[model samples]
Target chain A: MALLHRRLERSYSARSQGPLAAHARTLAVDAAERLGRLQPGNDFSAPLMVAVAVDLAQANAGATARELLERTLRLEPDCEPALLALGFSLERAAEHQQAAATYGRLVELRPDHHEGRLRLALNLIRTGRRPEGEAGLRGLLGAGTPTWVATLAAQELVRLLIAEERLEDAGEAARAALLRTPGDQRQWILLASILHSQGRRPEVLEALRALPAASRGVAPRARYSEWPDLGAAASQSRLGELARGAESRLAAALVEIGR
Target chain B: MTVARCVPLLALALAAAAPAAGADIWVTITAPREGEYAIGEVEIAAEVVARAEVAEVEFALDGRVVGTLVQPPYRLRVDLGGQSIAHRLAVTARDAEGGQATAEVSTLPPPIAADFEVELRQLYVSVSRDGERVLDLNGADFTITDEGVEQPLVTFARGDIPFTAVLLIDASGSMFGDKIRAATAGAATFIAGMKALDQAQVLVFSDQLLVRTPITDAKEILAAGLGGTEARGGTALTDSLFVALQLLEERQGRRVVILLSDGIDTHSVVDMEQASALARTSSALVYWIRFARDADNPFDDGGVTMTSAWRSSQEYGRQIELLTRAVRESGGEIIPIRRADEIAPVFLRILDELRSQYVLGYYPDDRRGDGRWHRVRVKVDAPGAEARAPRGYVDD
Candidate 1:
């Protein structure tokens, strides 16, 4: 359909700033007009409408886009792209629970969808279902998922394990993620922080220095404000407190070393 | 007679045992599946299975009743704070017929504690006096502030640091013939100027993007990628820049995007606002190269005329303005070329400035990583000398 082509072009343009972005915007406006003539339940019209809504969402009209996407899903629940877009929009609006539910349903509908599973796992963690979330991430890695997905899952697993004071497990998970994307500075920091917690100051310094010098200075854009304490989960475990203590000690060390 | 009596007795016993229907009810705890929770509002979801009409569901933590729900999807939110220890989470479902079922789960909740952390912010500073770069400025010669509060410089490194750059060339229909060739040559010149540790990727965009070369320091690879590129299709400069930003997001060291385009946005889904947003937030410096052939002479021959392209519409002017703003916000420079030969020199000049610029790192005086934008101003001790640094950063 003309609407479909225009929508696709508009998607491309929205990501690009070249001449095509303006052209795509104009074409999408025209396509939106023609879209009304098409009947609902035409198999393609629902997606087209969803596409129009996506274009609007890119323009910062997320609420309008969310309504349109919901309407389209009301008619056809199997629209994958629309469902994904809706989940992302919900996330942008800080509706984490709704986004998690949406992604949960998406994973249920398409059991083998990597992106859906990834989003579902992350949202579950966000909603404080750490065990289920960790299981989902582990499952993805064990199922031979894409490298990027596996990398992301491993990274999240490290954070979850660290929050539980499972230092050895966190180190293992961090190492796995690092092997996949050595360029990710956050993973390096996670590893370094873990080492610092075990009284292994030399190992912590080694881990920090192992990272590319340029990336060593960088940190994740977001972090958990609190660190978990040792033996928090198990009564007989030998862990101390969360990684924050180590982070403080390390910060002082860094300042002392003056890199 | 004895056999018939025994069969009747067995049937009566079975009937008595199965006397009631629709009398069972059960509840199950769905969240905190690992029996552990992070320190925060923990959402407890419970599902009820009942053969009879359900009256209500009661939620409890550590044997104390917290709240009751009379809905299909029984749920409750409990603030689990004060200590990092294990507690019992329980739920009970009661049927209208007085039958009840209970489920309990033990979970270790995270302790509420504060993390003393610092984030090191990197700023690439360029100092110029009368259009020439000044590279000898030391850390003492520069003063930096965030939101008007002075920050101490903790890390300072300059020159010989590895750089990562992306050569974004426009191969749109309007840039046919000599323009594409000159752009390719200019790109090759830029790559040749890089140090052994530096890497660059070449991306040519028309309506779609083509990877001329992956990120590499090898000269042969750079040549093979930039060579044999032709102009076709519509321009998608914004898309290419967005892609460039994404590619450089996680890379280490100085990130730069050398964008060579005619300043005309034709066919891109991304508008100026989005581009500007990325530009404002990106750690990468964007150098926009706008090529025009003799704006003063429209009747000249023997070369492609880019002056006509700029003079054709107001849209062109707007596009140029957008690019200029992006450059300024990114603390980068925009060079307008009047001849094809100027392209190579401009590329070299950018490389020179990049190599000679100063790097400053400091932790914000305001250590609260509350995700707020803090404006940064870098000042040089030299009088009449202007310094360019990142305008601001979002603390996280």
Candidate 2:
């Protein structure tokens, strides 16, 4: 009788475990389905969808990837990842504003996300937000960022500032960036630009001439060669002609150095 | 005074009996500017006595001989159509060398008629943050407010509508490396996406504008130009856009311009404000694609090393924003694409939006030629329908 009772208990325990496992699987599927249904079309709904999709996709229920993406967006429109995903999707779908908003949300959420930040910066550029977008990038670089991200961000920022005729700020930013990463060829070019804008002809020439030889950490040699050092001669001459007295003399000296 | 009056009446009676008449010469030159005139049509009229012997009259423009007419008190009209702008008109009459007299006439400036019309043809699409092919509605979506009242949309249509497109490429020296590749590719993609019947032109500008191909088959011209792109001059984006707008002005259908550049107007003769005005008046949509290098580093020296990139990117951002504003004001959108690979899909999406549009045309009751800009209003009477159309049209 005792043995029969033990056997019955064991059988019941095994049956109970089977149902519990099934329930867990069912819960996962349900979560995935909920996520998949959340397709948020706008900035407000993109992030939520992304987060849920990430969660579901991570769980090995690969089939729920789309569903997970959809549901989270349906719940919270402004979720960041969801926004990024939605932005990416919309971009793929050729919906620019919706995508821009998603990227903008990503920028708001993770300012340090370089990819997100870069994308937002680019979008802002496309939309004509020059100073603000550049300032954002400069702020990031000023925070002592590392390696390639810093290099790329600094290079782009300097070029834009120079183009916009913000010489003083460009000079300061370029100098600061150069101090941190001296091997950056773009920074050197930027320094030359600042000096040129400031009418420091000799300094500009020196800066260009002082550019280190193609080496580790410096910009590619091919890029450096494309700088048009000799091509700037006409502009330098024009600057010299425009300057009077000491300024002209200084410009001449710079021209000589450039030569 | 009474005697004088009687004498005048006597002379008038004698003149009436004889019906005596004299010749008067008048010349009219219908050119836009005094310094510049096309070699088109010039009208000259001379009133003369029935039996008067008017020797010869000579017409000249800018010291060069245009034509000569030898007839009594007669009207002569010269057609100088199809001539470029930069000519003048001077008329001289020579009954004899000693009796020769010359009359010079300066042409009036270009007319600013209120009845000017501009249409938005194609809207370029680009990928946004959410990975969707969307139109950038910055400067393009303008609200028409007449006397502080909002107007309604009269017509709206997508890609199915016939429109003119201009592709402006940057041949600036700074657009080197991957940018040149991407721009060419983007342009090719845009051309590929156009409908067979659609017309598009490709213009590459740096210090000057160069029209690589006129509005024709997108596939053939695009393929020929896309692979041979060379970057070697200062940026003149503003000037390029202005030229594109001018070209689009004569077009009957919708007009749009797609600009590919790094957003640096280094050597543009025209400023942003002027460009903006031209864009607004012409109602041309401007789509700017900014090419930026990827950021692989996140931290170094308080992020100072990234300043150059940041500033350039930001300037590009501002230019785009301004362009967006321009487009939106004209009921168009600004599309921004980051990845070069995104160009094709974005172009396709723009084409799709254009195709999906529903065009609604209506004739208003007010048809007075008042020589004024009139506001147009279009509204969706349906409960949930949306509408879009030109904010206004000029009525003359």
Candidate 3:
């Protein structure tokens, strides 16, 4: 029986994606359930349950997912992934304070967990604790933080400032993010957007025209290369495609600008 | 012969002689698929199969009539009453042949934050040359394809065809004062420009519905829908857009959805793929008037940046990708603006573009309900002329 369970695990791992993945996972989950039924539950059951919960959520089986996550948390209170998933679920359900608390537990378990920090901060903002949330986001911009996390932090901070009607602060934050990762595509777009928001059209055009091209062979993301990075996406169905190099993107932006 | 044996033989003979197909009505509940957590209000959709023509579909919630729908894509919105208990939702489709099909979905309490899948759509198009609207195009002037297979035209119109639109305004917390006002003004302007023949509804949302106006051409009603709303919640752009698409599905003629958002969807349960799926299904023109940068893909450091909420950076990236595709696929475009002030003009300009458009549509030769992305391309026969239509539709 144990060998069978192991085989199920191996099979699921082998087909973790594609059409057969879900079937493989269902088999693994059923095996896991049978194993739990036959043997005393232990630490092994918690992670397995968490994985099952993730699958359930993906399949739109949210109630079951929530219940499984709850059971998993009860068994292993410090499960980071479980905590994160529960927090997100709560946030989605519009229980911001509860979501924050769940995220708080994850943060306590792993202080450096990037998502935990971001979501906790976000919930704080939703609950009207803007300053605290802003501070939390600012902390993610520390030098030791991962580039991706920090970049997101910068973007969120800029967006928060922009939302708060501090246009200059938002622009400064965008520039600061650019300074951190000068070659980042999105930050440049952010900076250009800020200038445009301040009603500086010529400057917006200048800034975009100077956008650094995608770095050597960086696999173009769907949006970065093909998705209209600039122009009116509202219906570009009728407009022309603007893509690839910097100039093309600028021309797209120009279309939106009515320049 | 024994009497019992003779009866069994007669019944078997009658059953064997009966036609094997299309004898019974089939109404299958297709949405709220898992019935696990249907948070907020969900659109109950059902697929009905019947040999007889469907007369009407009665949507009942907890055994009460929610609405009577008369068509394929039988759908109706049901509020979950903010309960965490189980509830029974059923749909009964009655057809012209007097056959009835009944489908029911029991949604237990603790519903999701937002999820409602309803119906599907086709295509809208516009052609331009040298920075000007190419007004003189005809059905013969364009060629089209679906999923790389060329399709013949089914319908063609080049004038100001009547349309129904949904002005999806984001009144999330970030849009508190000026931003919300500007978005409202823009939506109002669009409503004002609507011809008596053209009707639209205003759907304002921030995590949940702030305001929803009935589909109408009355400017006063439209203005009232836009009047005085506070932006104090999280952004549920995808969920709100799903609702917008649902509204468009029931309308005839060209359907349009003009979304005013910052591209950040924090509280939506629908996510991007589902929203895009609904867009393709509704075949409505989606105009995204964006105000901010594309939300960052958290996958900058492999998967380390993934949010625990399962909105992993990878997921977020995929979300952004699908959303961009949804916009393009809807034969609509995104108009990115920096400030609140530019919103009203953009809305008016979109109205003008709607008027200038040449709507063209075609049925794919071998595509119907296969649930696949059929890439579409439209080419203008005239030199220097270019055409734009949605990238494709999901014939699911």
Better of 1 and 2 by DockQ: 2
Query: What's the DockQ of model 3?
Result: 0.02
> What is the C-alpha lDDT profile of model 3 across B100-211, one tens digit per residue?
7576677755422334322212356788788678898778987887777777764455656567899999887778888898889888888889875578888887655667
Interface RMSD of 3: 13.9
lDDT over C-alpha atoms for residue A227 of model 1 = 15
List, for all models, the DockQ compared with the true complex: 0.01, 0.02, 0.02
Identify the superior model by lDDT, candidate 1 or candidate 2: 1
Q: Pick the candidate with the highest TM-score.
A: 3
Q: Classify candidate 1 by CAPRI docking class.
A: incorrect
TM-score per prediction, in order, is: 0.42, 0.36, 0.44
For B1-396, candidate 1 gives per-residue lDDT tens digits of: 112233334434332122123436556677766456433235677766665677888988778786687876676655443234677888888877787877777786443344655445678888889989887778898899989998887556565456789999988767788888888999988888886657898888774565546677887898788877878766657756766775665565578999988766654434455566667766788888876634675222233222211122344455556777788768787788776677888899999888777877776667576757778899999967789888887665
True contacts kept of each: 0.00, 0.00, 0.02
lDDT of 1 at A95: 67
- lDDT (10s digit) by residue, model 3, range A1-259: 2223333444665666444555554564555455555664543454565655665665656677788778767666776767887776676555678889998998998998876797798788878889999999999987888665676667667767866879898888888878887875545555655664576867765665555543332211211111111112321222112112434565677899995
Model 1 / residue B322 / CA error / Å: 3.8
